[model samples]
Every structure is written in structure tokens, then in C-alpha cells.
Target: MASREGSLSVVIPAFNEAGNIGDLVIETIDAVPASLLREIVVVDDCSDDGTEDVLKRLSVTIPALRYVRHGARAGQSAALRTGVRTATAPLIATMDGDGQNDPRDILKLLAALEAPSGETVVLAGGVRTQRR
Candidate 1:
């Protein structure tokens, strides 16, 4: 089994999350095993909230950060599919960009994937706290 330090890709779907993208990226980086997931792809669904601008600014500093925009405004699922298809890593992880999911739990999910049972599993975490 490969350690969590192996290469991994994180895909985030954004739809008007100009306010959350930056912080989300930072938290995701902090949560992932540094040696494992150095690349993150943020797929925007043709957001009109200046998300493109934020990403443009971020790309300058975050070397592993990648921003992909839908030629037309596609839904979240489409954006997710795009990000996954474009990912360069053998393993891919996804998280919501609405500030609802905790990035710190990423490691736990990765650990689940490495379980010794040798069975395929999909790990999902639900938030009990409400955003309202």
C-alpha cells in the first residue's frame, strides 16, 4: 500500500465562491500530507463573481494550483468531471467549495483508501453543523 505521501490530486468545484476559494485552497493544502497532494484543481462553472480574477492572482503564487473554467456555465457535476478528467494524479479527491466541508478531514479519507481490506470504498464525511 502506498503511503499518504504519494502523489494525489484534489478537485474543488466552485460556482460563485469568490469569497471562499482562497481560504479553501489554503486549508486544503494544510490538511493534505504535504508530500502527497501538492496539486489542486479548482474548476469554476463560469462564475460571474470575479472568481476568475481571484484565481488569476492566486496562480502567480501557488505553483501547484490550477484553475479551469467552463467555456459555458456548466453545473457542478460537469465541473467536477472536468477537473477529474484533467487531473494528472492516479488518485483524486474532491471537496465542496461552499465552506461546508472541513479540509482537515482529507487525511482520514485518504487513510480509508489505504485500508488493508483490499476492498474498494468511497468515503464521505457529513457535517453536522449548519451553515445558516
Candidate 2:
């Protein structure tokens, strides 16, 4: 079963998430199956809040982490574009940097993608329920 499901690429775009990037990376690493995850790309959009620094520091701990540096502060779309272009994996995943989304949810998406007869499906994230 593991051999059938292809690799996954997770793209995390950050502008000023120095305080959250470390934890987020750790949680994301722990959340997904190591065999399924190809890489985790964190695109730094010229963040002034030391996000790039945080990512560099994190690379020491997270081996799967890859950093993409931007010259200036670009919007999320630009960051995402950079990430997607740089990613080598066929399955690309994206998430926000505010720490609101749970990394564990990635498993659900991966499972759904592995479902029989489910191909060429683009998963767009939608928040319609509250945990409370």
C-alpha cells in the first residue's frame, strides 16, 4: 500500500511567521508519514520578522526542510508559485502560516487521494466546521 501511493510535497508560504515556523515544521513532520512526504518547502517572502532565520535554524533539526528565499516581500501567490515550481514531488500540498490549520489533517487528504478511482483531483481547502 505504501509503495502504491506516490510522494508528497508540502509547501508552506511565510511572510512573518518566525514565532510559529519552528513548531509548525515539527508538527508537520510528526503528522505525516515519513515515507509519503518527499519534502517540505518553506518559501520566505522577504519576511522582516526573522522567519528566514527561523527556517535556517530549523533545517538543522528537520532534514526534509528546504528553503526558498525571495528578494522582496511578495504576496502569497508569488511565494506559492516559487514553492510549487521548486517542488519535485508530483503531489503538492499547501497550507497557511498562521498556525490555524492542523498538520494532522494532511493524512486525511493523503488517504483520500489514495482512494481507488480517485485521480486528477485537486484538493482545495475549505473550513466549514468548528471544533467547539
TM-score of each: 0.86, 0.87
lDDT of 2 by residue, 64-108 (tens): 999998998889999999999999888888877767778888877
**CA lDDT, every model vs. true structure:** 0.82, 0.83
Model 2: what TM-score?
Answer: 0.87
lDDT by residue (tens digit), candidate 1, 11-58: 999999999888898888788766888589999999999888888798
lDDT of 2: 0.83
Q: How many clashing residue pairs, candidate 1?
A: 0
Candidate 1 TM-score over all chains jointly: 0.86
RMSD of each: 2.3, 2.4
